[model samples]
Target: MDKDTGKAFDFRLFKRLMRHTKPYRLTFYGVALAAILLSGFAVATGVIAGDIVNDAISPKDADKLLFLSLLMLAILFAQVLSQLGFNYYANWLGESIIKDVRISLFQKMLGFKMTYFDRSSIGLLVTRAVADMQRIGEIFSQGFFVIVADLLKMLTAAIAMLVLNWRMALIVFALLPIIMIATRLFQKAMKVAFIEVRAQVSNLNSFVQERITGMKIVQLFTREEIEKENFRGINEKHQNAWLKTVWYNSIFFPIAESVSSIAVALMVWFGVLQNVANVGSENTGIIVTFIFLIELLFRPLRQIADKFNTLQMGMVAANRVFKILDTESHIDDLGTVEKEDVKGDISFSDVRFGYIADEEVLHGISFDVKAGETVAIVGATGAGKSTIINLLSRFYEINSGMILVDDIDIKAYKLSSLRDKIAVVLQDVFLFADTIANNISLKNNEVSVADIEQAAKQIGVHEFISSLPGGYQYNVKERGTMLSSGQRQLIAFLRAYVSNPSILVLDEATSSVDTYSEQLIQKATEKITEGRTSIIIAHRLATIKKADKIIVMDAGKIVESGNHKELLKKGGYYSNLYEAQFMAEEVA
Candidate 1:
């Protein structure tokens, strides 16, 4: 959960948001110019109404009245056009700004270290990227520029009032202080209410997203009723948060309306008295114009309070988004080396690392794999098997020591160039909601459809894929849920094979497959690892029997290192783990 800063106006945040508009400055300036025109047109319409009553009608000059009526209609037409430009251009600018911000935000998220995501909520991040971004955009579309135009109109109206009759103008302003103070109070109260609203929105999004994504787990354990009850509680909180804003609006707008009525009544009372006394230039026309001016002034007083709420919500959203943009959790790609044609040799020299501080997962582990060698790392469930893979790919940085590839520190290579030579197929294969061919190629135009088919055939999964309804064109759906676990694993193998990486990683890759797919995977494994350095992490000791080296780990340290038969001969940690972890699979 995020803490509320309880600020009414955050200038630093405001400036940060304004910087997004730099790319669309021309549209921003156009919107500003339209606002100015709108204010001017508004004041012109009010002044013309006054002239129609005072000069055009009083002398009963038919020609002058006809000309003035036509002029007023023309002004109204222009006002309509200006209003359209203001609304359209403002919204255009807002959408454009949010589009750019979302792009940057997505790019930033893509660059963050995997550990950052490990501790962050996917649902809450979705809320920030989608819902909160909309609110930030409303700052331009419905909040900032509209308020500026309204304020300009009010200032113009106030000047017109003073010029016509100073006494009546002073009477109108007598009630102004009361409304101003009420507005100030309303702004503060609504700020707090809206902050609560934003917080609840994120909570609601997170809850709903998690429940929906894990609905299978909920139903499997017969927890649907309990989950629904939990959701109802969250929904209630969300409703209550919104209702707080509603309650504030109900209380404040009425006070503003009462103030507006009082001002109108006072203006009418004094204007009538002065007209009767014949002391000043008080006429029916002046009183009529004052009515227009009063509406122009008091309406914005009511509306500015509402717009201020919009502005406050936008500021809150900006603060949240900027927090993500300011995060320094991205992986450091400081190395200038961009080697694409290198021998596949990997070394971990005294590598130490932790997912959390002072609780190391990899404790001074060291290993070396010669070019074109196949190595298998076997361990119990929490024996830091997967951590080695993550560190090799640089998904998480090591706390101390060095990881070298081809005699160069892994950190001393450009990230993309380094990762391009490496590929990993995990036990849990993730496929996008696209066709099988696209998933295999990863939408890489360089790998043609023919290339994908050739790789799948060479890997021995071509028959299995062709047996499906659409074969290569089959839509895997989200995370390949439509396909069986074995099928998904085969797809992962094909994906890696097509990339033709110099280094391959298989982390329990064939553990989920059935007997037939397991045979296919074994054949694919042999073909793919022929000319590349391969790292295999498997609990099935039989699969790694022919490896060039076998490294057995326990509690983050390598306990045994030898060929499979040699480790078995030693009757040490490897022999015991081989019996404990793989004997059941051998029996089945």
Candidate 2:
């Protein structure tokens, strides 16, 4: 699913992921200190046991035994405190780092070019931003630090064994290599399995999200059975990927348990022989301590496999998340100019653009709209009407030539400032699950309730809004489902009108509405386009007959330019298109 899927761990990705921790270095240092304390406390527990057996319990010295018992209890207390601190701070650091990472990822995506979003999957991105970030957090909270602490305990235990009885320790250490070999194989296999798991998770999420968003289409076309089968196949792949990890775990853990068991048995066998041969009586305490030491050493070796799996999964997620972070799809905002006000004079001088490289959608098109003038563009479906709107807002960069506003290149103005001066009403209006006033003013503090009401009044839709249950406070719900298409368009128009923009664009704004709504929209249009630079792109030529100029587009080129009366007199592209489409609508 991604490069480095074969790697059990990636140090590069790990380092990059850790960089987000710099801001919380104090918490990181505190967690590190706690981990070291926990390891030390763990080792002391075993040594204290030996002291109790040899110095107190063995000789039946009641006083010494009581003191050692209290000492061991105190060590237990310290260990618990250290563990508490370790778990808290490590998890705190993790949550903090992921919070910053998530925000940075969102900010980066916010600046991406429209072309980047045009082809990207929404569900896949949601996975990267939400699910993958938690995996990265687990790397710190439960993965890396836990593995290090466990290994530390093991190392300290190993040294204590060597000091107590070297021969028995060596015998126990012989089986260590066998466990290591198995663990290494397990890590590699698990890494590959986790990669597949993540890939399938993303695929399933994308499929379900698309199906849910377009559930209407599926039901309308009667495709539910087919979709269910597709989901089952994707879900099975997800399950099988996890089952592979389970299979590897099943084979590996039992082998590890057996080797450790044999190691413990060998230590006892050797210790018993030394005592029977009249060796040092001190071997009694040493034998008991070795029991604790062996558990410490081998148990982490077994448990490390689990933590390493988390580490591996986190690295895989980090790799995928970093790819998005490293993508260079942002539209350049290098322009130093910021305008307080803009004149709405617009000109596209031989402008050309393609959503994809070398596949031009608008080929060297040219047009001009002077301040306070209205221009209409009539085109067939794919004649590049929307592409012009995208270019003017700097959502997509022009491939060649210049787009000027007030005779200055659009690129010369700061992107935000340029967009602030324009408002667009598209054929499809999108509203959030927010109040109607919010959808209109869009939470701009400058536009108040009074302002929205006044603008709605000016656009002649105030009466429609006031008729609703809560008037401007009405919750339109997601995509404005509570409202009709005509009502949504009225909201869109009032939204655009309230902006008081220097330039305005209406893209098929009046299509797909009832006659009464059309009448209302026509009145709104007449008032809103009064003194603003307006660009109207429509298929219905009847809507723009009074426009000062009309440009006809076909297959990415401007075929005719004139007023409606002049074009009809010339019997050109606009006249022929108008005749055909108008006649068809009339017949219908």
Per-model lDDT: 0.90, 0.91
Per-model TM-score versus the true fold? 0.98, 0.98
lDDT for 180 in candidate 1 is 90
Expressed as tens digits, the lDDT of each residue in 1-588 for candidate 2 is 776677778887888887888899888888888878887888888888888889888799999999989988999999999999999888888888889989989999999998788889999999999999999999999998999999999999988888888888899888999999999999999999999999999998999999998998999999999999999999999999999999999999999999988988888888899989978777777878888888999999998998999988888888888899999998888776777667799999999988888999998999898899899998899999988999999999998999999989989888888998999999999999999999998999989999999989988999999999999999999999999999999999999999889999999999999999999999999999998899999999999999999999998999999899999999988889889989999999
Query: Which pairs clash (backbone N, Cα, C closer than 3 Å) in model 1?
Result: none
Per-residue lDDT tens digits for candidate 1, residues 449-544, read: 899989988989989999998999999899899998889999999999999898999999989689888998899999999989999999888899
* Model 1, global lDDT: 0.90
lDDT of 2 at 288: 80
Top-lDDT structure, candidate number: 2
Error of 1 at 384 (Å): 0.7
RMSD of 1: 1.4
